[model samples]
Each structure stands twice: as C-alpha cells, then as structure tokens.
Target: MPEASFSRGAHHPPTATASTAAASTAAAARGPDGPGAGLLGSLAPLLAEWLPRQRWFAGKGRPVTGFALVSATEILPSPPGGTTPGLLHLLIRAQQPEPPGHRHGFGCGHRRGAAASDCYQILLGVRTTLPPSLAPALIGRPSGGPLDGRTVYEALADPRLASILLERLRVPGRLDPLRFVREPSSAIPSILPPRLMTAEQSNSSVVYGDTFILKLFRRVSPGTNPDLELPLALARTGCTRVPAPAAWFEAAPPPEGPGPRPEPFTLGVLQPYLAGSTDGWQLALDALAVRADFTDAAHALGHATAEVHLAMADALPVSVLRRPQIEHLAAAMSERLDSAAAAVPALQPYRGALHAAYEDVAALGRTGRTWAAQRIHGDLHLGQALLTAERQWSLIDFEGEPSRPLAERRRPQPPVRDIAGMLRSFDYAAAVGGHDTPQDWAGGMRAAYCAGYAEASGTDPRDEPELLRAHETDKAVYEVLYEARHRPDWLPVPMTAIRRLAAAVR
Candidate 1:
C-alpha cells in the first residue's frame, strides 16, 4: 500500500467529474435503495481477497469462507452535481472456518467455543471510475449489481470523504441504525480536512488539523468500547492523565421486543489530539540511546497508572475475587502456559517452574487471600503511555489485548495484571538496546515505577508477592509465544526473563 500523504492545510472537497459522472447520476436517480441492495454481494469476492492484506484483519492466516452483511446504509448522498461518487457504510460479518485441530486448554477457557463470524466496519467510496489519487485504496471493480463496473475503495483513506464523515459526526443525528453522537461539551469544527494516520495497526485514525483525531474501529463488537468507556469514566472523576472523549459514533441494531437489549457497537471515537506528545516506548528508546536515566519518567508513568486505576475503581464496578474465581484464574494461566510450551519449544524446559508459579496463586487462594479486581487498562505497556513536552504521562488505548474476546477484555481483573505488562515492556526496551545501558537499568526503572505506584495508590505491588509474581510469569509466558511467532530475533528477550523467573521459583 502507498503511504498516506497529506498537505498541512489542504482541503480536498469530495467531488468527482469523470466517466463516473454518468454512473453517479444513475446512482443518484435510483435513490437510496439503489445502492444499498446487491452492493454487498457484488463486493463479497473482492472483500475476501482484500481483507487479508489489511493490517487490521484479525483472521489473517485463516481462509474467509464468506461474508454476511449484517447492516448496510448510504451515509452520504450523491453530490449535488455529481453522478459517479457516493459513500456507503457497512457492518459485515465475515465467516472463517476454525483452524484444524484447534483445542481449548486451561487459562484458555475464555476463548473456548469462539464464534466463527467476526464483524468489521467498512466505509466505501463508490465510483464508476477510480480517482488517480485513490488508486492505492482500491477494492477492485465490481462486475455486476448496483455498483457494477464501479470502482470501490475504502473511503476513510480519502481525505475528502473522511472530512465528510467527520462533519456528520460533529452533529448528532441518526441514519437508520447508525447513530452519530457528540459529547455535550465537545467543540468540533464543522469543516476540518482530515489526514489519515498511517502508523495505526488494528484501527484507522484520521487527524483533523492537529486538533482532534477520530479513531474508526475496524473489527467491532457488542457492548461499549473500553477505549471510549474508560476514558469517559476517568474524565468524569477529574482525571487529567487521560484524553477526554469528545465525540463518538456507534451502530445500534433495532430492538427485537418491548424489553429487548440491543447490542450497541462502537464504530468510532473522536478525542482531542495530543500534537506535541511522544509515546513512552519511543521516549524510553531515546533515553536508552543516550544512556540517560529513565527512572523519573518511569516513576511518573506509575503514578499516572495508579491514578487511573483509582479513578476506575471509583467510577466503575469493582469485585473481590473469592476462592472459586481465584481457582478459575489459576486454571486459565496454566492453560496458557501449556499452550505456550507446546507452541514454543524453548518454553518446554521451564514449563514445570511456570506451573509452580500458577500453583502458588492457587495456594495463596487456599489460605483465603482475597484479591480486588476491577476494570483496568487491560493491555497496558510502554506504548500505551504518552509523555507530553511538559513531562506529564497520559494513558491511551484502553481497548485491551485485541486478540482476546470482548467479554474477556471487559471482565474485571487484578490491577497488577497491567503492572506486569508495563514491567515486561521495560525489559523489552532494555533488551532492544542492551549494549548501550547498564545491566540493571531496566531493573532500576522498574523499582522506581513500583515505588511511585505505592506512593500514589497507598498499596505496594510488592506487598502481594505471590499475585505479582504469578502475573509477571503469566505475562512472560505470553511474550515468549508472541515473540516466537512474530519476532524470532526478539524471542531471547522474553526467554531470558522466563529462565530467570523459573530459576527464582526453583
């Protein structure tokens, strides 16, 4: 794919005048029903072929059997004088066959009997002839149906159409099942040209003149998105460590009965963009390059984390894990360890020691050691944190681990799970540039971080040694599997931690 290019202040209006002019006119004449029907079927084959190439597609390695159109609507009507271009919105359920010989094990219960269909949000720019600038976003020309011989591409990649969508979001309205909502206090410009952010992985983000960013969720699910939900909750409690949610959009399926519960799928979120801020991951790497002490920054990050946790505990529901829940948690960890060991040969040698770490959790539970659980930054790490030019830390991306199911990510978990993730991230930074830093650089930073956490939350993570250790071991095991699969060269980083952790237990 071509890299997204944008001029700082250019406003590309959504207009097309080519051979598509006739097609656009034809589409406009047919009214709304013209494009909605048969559009999905026409693009089914093309979507199946195109989706896998996208970075955000979760079922990358698997074959897509077919697409089931859950919802389709025309969000933007044809231009006043145009005949060739229109905007079509879709929520498609993609069907993929389960991998052969896939089985569920302990800790893996959350994912057992997983759904075969995954829903995706697609915004298409439909035209009869492709624009020269949008060739890169092409989804292929449909040979039949309402869009026959029409060039269709992902609309968000087009700044003109993206701006149009942003305008729609700036005002609260409903187009059938899709609802565009704006926070009452939000101040959004009616016309700010959008620039697509290419650095995004699982979702597409568009920045409007460095003032606000709209994150369009690709793979969507029922229930509230924690990315918007948690930050909104934190903002309510006067938390400054998170960006306030300005506006958001969602698609709510029609109610089935008088008391029916319709699952609302968050389609996009708009937040004030932090223009001059840098992510913690890059800041750590920069500090490592100069051999600068990152303890201060790490300390601040810990304090921010604790603040968010405390605010979440105040704003959302909290639970105390009893013996049964603790047992289930331990079993889940053991299952993950077994799966990792089977996948990564290097983990087999340390499997017994890892099992002991999980067993320790079970033993602690047997002694009636209760633990507090609440909604947290489910996938916290260095990358999830942002450090402003003023040296303050802000948390971003509360979507949690994208691979996990929606219900699992929303379930309450010990806050230490997040701390463990950050701890592992520190080790990763040290390993990435091990030669430039002192042997205990990462360790020192980790200690300072925990110290800061204890100071802010008034509860030391180190006080719960068994819970912390088991969570850390569980995180390391996950890293081993992830590294082995995605980054073989980085496998040693987590492997080293695994060896030390296992030996410590021994």
Candidate 2:
C-alpha cells in the first residue's frame, strides 16, 4: 500500500454544485418520486451503480444485494458551487453477515453537466447491533466518527470500537452459514464474504482478491481520524517499520462549503496490497523458533513505536498528550468492566476472576503517569501488527474495534492497554509459533520488548509492575470474552490466559 501522508497526485478541477441543487429541489418538488420513486429513485439506481466502485462498498464487483433508503435529509451543496442541495441518506441491506447492513448513506457531491444529480457528502454510522455470540469481543466505544452526519472527536484518545473491531477479525467471526442461505445476485455475485477483515472493518480497504478491510466510525466527534492523523506524523519520523499507508480517503466532509451539509464524509483508503509478509503472530512464532534475539527486534520496534507517538504529539493538534486524570482511573475501569461483564455472558463465568483482576488493574492504574495519554494503536495485538521486509513491525487498522461505542474508544485509558497488547501478542506468538507447545519463551520476548520500550521511552514499568500486571490480568479476562465470541476455536487461548491470571492472584 502506498503511504497516505504523501500524496503525489496533481491538482484536478474543483467540484460543481448547480446541477446538485436543481436536482434535489426538483425531486423534492417533484414529490420524491415522479414516475418510479421517480427522479429520486432514478438517482438511487445511479448511486447503486456507483456504490460498488466506492472503497467503502463491500460487494462492489458482485451484484448489489439491495438498496433501500432508511432516511433522507437535504443539505446545501459546497460553496462556490452555490445553493445546490443534495440528499443525505442512510442506505441499508442484508450484507454478508446475514444481518446485511448499510452500504452507508451518501451525500453525493454536486452532480454536474447534464446529470442534474443531487448529492454532496456521506456520513456513516460506526456502530451496528450484532448477534449475542459476537458481542463480547466488541468492546470500547468509537474513537471518532460521522454519526447522524458529523465529524467526531477532539482529543488524543483510544477508540471505543477497539474491542469488538479486533475480535471480528479473528478467523471464526462468521455466523452460522446454514442460517442465511445464499441469495440471488442482481449483477454478478457478492464477493464480499460474511467474515469481516480488520483492515476492512476499520478503513474501507479492498483488493482485487484475497483481502478487504472496512473502517467503522461512531462517536462522530470533530476532527480527522487518527488513521488519517498518525501516519502523517510517522512519515515525518521516516520510520520504515509501519506499513506505508497505501492510500487513505476520508469522508472529506465539506467545511463551510456553499451550503448546509448533513452527511460528514465518505470512506476512502487504498493500499499497495501486502501479499506475502507474515502476520506478526506467525512471525513471532517464527522468531521464537530460532534464536533468542527477539529482544533486539523488540527494542527496535519499541523505539519505532515511541518515535511515532512522540512525533504525533508534536505534529498533530489532537495528538497532544491527554491531561492527567484521577489516580483511581482503574476504579472507573473496574466499574465499567464489572457492569459490561454482567451484560456479556461469556465474561460472566469469570466474574469473580474479573473482580480480582479489576482490583489489581485499579491499583496499578493509580501509579502510572496519569497524564501520559496520547493517541495509541487502540487495538494492538499480534494480529493488528504486521511485519515488513525491512524486518520491522508495522501497525494497521486505526478505526479501532467496531463493536465498541464511539465515545469510549475516544476515552483516555492508561497507555498500558497498548503495552499489555504487545505483551499479549508475544504470548500469542509463542503459543501459535511453537506448534501449540506451551513455553516460557513468551516471557523472555516480552521482557525484551519492555526493556527496549523502557530504554527509549524512559518508562519504568517495574515501579508499577503490580499495576501493570493488574491491567494485564483485567485485559486477559476481557480477551476471554473476545475470543469466545469472535473465534470460539480460539476461546481456549484466552481461557488459559484468564486461568493464569486468576492463579497468579491466588
């Protein structure tokens, strides 16, 4: 994938708005549907045709399963183009996941020339109600979004959707295939599978074949997303470890354009298409199989990550470090987890373990630098992290996890969530890489990673080991809930982890 931060494209002509206004008003005055749904429906078919071309659309090449407008509101077109109004609408369907969702609502940018088209922008809802089985893995709130047609977020916070989003990427996030029998295709067939990929779940990423990633938004705060923010900062750091951002397209909401716009932005992101790089989980196992040099690689990755974070704080306004909060932040987390856990059956079995884990996390949450908050890879894991030929680790999918609400993903939790994520990755790496042979190798790799991070970040985890351990444990319980729903086969991975955490406490 090409880097999003560096755009080499030449300038093009600006958009037009005259036709957009004429079309919207004409349709409204034309009574929404003159002949079929009439002119409006005429436009729907046009949009249906264009949707598959979109980076966000799931089944582009295949036939559009269906197109129906849930709601529509008119908004003024971008300025310079004048008062041309366009429809801001929500489009839904039965997509691959059986529940079939939205192709998303679009505010088609001013339709020009002979088309007399009415469109200007798009605002997508980041949250979706899923089956109970898949709910536990979807944790966190959306970090930023375009909800009810608006940009969301104002700070350097974690994405609420992280938990669920990450879980959905696991291998078995699919629903019972037998439930939703295959349907007929209008054009060809739906190439979009029922299973959602991480890149697809977060950013609208697609390929000719093999992989597609979707980006989800919620919270609808106000600012460019970090997926758009951090890569630019990292580019300045000139780090080779991260994936070259391929291509990223934001909903690109018009600000103070010629009119009153409702929808916020469109989904856009394209990448070079990483074909053969080993997944971090696979690489971790591979590395462990060899020498004990995992520490050196870990140190380099630490500096790379630290460098990105530090640079982000300096460059982007939102990347500025979050303010200090109460030392008892863990108390708040425990409370949230306790409440959420009750609602999640998968987490219920380990309720007592959760409470104990919470106490430890609450204790640790008290000691870390309460003010050290900054934009983090909200859902860090062996899966979220990938490897590059430069022998560097790259991070992808910044939309956080989709299952979360937008608000929480935007909250500032301890940076330790990210730290714990890396540790977990190492654990997973050791588990899978060693042919399912349990080994203490993960510990050694984790120690090396910590040392590297501490060496450069000047962080002192030993001072807060208990606190870190507590956080790690709480996170582990959360993982049990995650894998259980998204990848039932992988449930044992986290179940064992929860047991380990509980035993440690005992």
* Residue pair clashes in candidate 1: 24-83, 24-84, 25-83, 106-335, 107-332
What tens-digit string does per-residue lDDT give for candidate 1 at 1-506? 00011010012111111111222222342344564445555677788788889999987788776555556678776543366478888877666655545665322222535535567898999776777888999998876667677778989888878988888888889987789998898889887878999999999899999999999999987788889899999999999999999999998854434666557989999998988999999998898888877899999888889999999999999999988999889998999899888888999989999889889899888889899999999999999999976778999999998778777888999999999999888999888866454337778888989988998999989898778889999999999988897889989889888987898788
TM agreement with the true structure for every prediction: 0.90, 0.55
What RMSD value applies to candidate 2? 16.8
Error of 1 at 380 (Å): 0.6
Could you tell me how far off, in angstroms, the CA of residue 61 lies in candidate 2 after the best superposition? 25
Per-model CA lDDT versus the true structure: 0.80, 0.44
Stretches off by above 4 angstroms in model 1 are: 1-35, 79-84, 100-115, 254-259, 436-439
**Cα RMSD of predicted structure 1:** 8.1
Instruction: Give the Å shift of residue 410 in candidate 1.
Output: 1.0
Model 2, position 258: C-alpha lDDT score: 48
Looking at candidate 1, the ten consecutive residues that score lowest on lDDT are: 1-10
On a 0 to 1 TM-score scale, where does candidate 1 land against the true structure?
0.90
lDDT for residue 297 in candidate 2, whole number 0-100 = 70
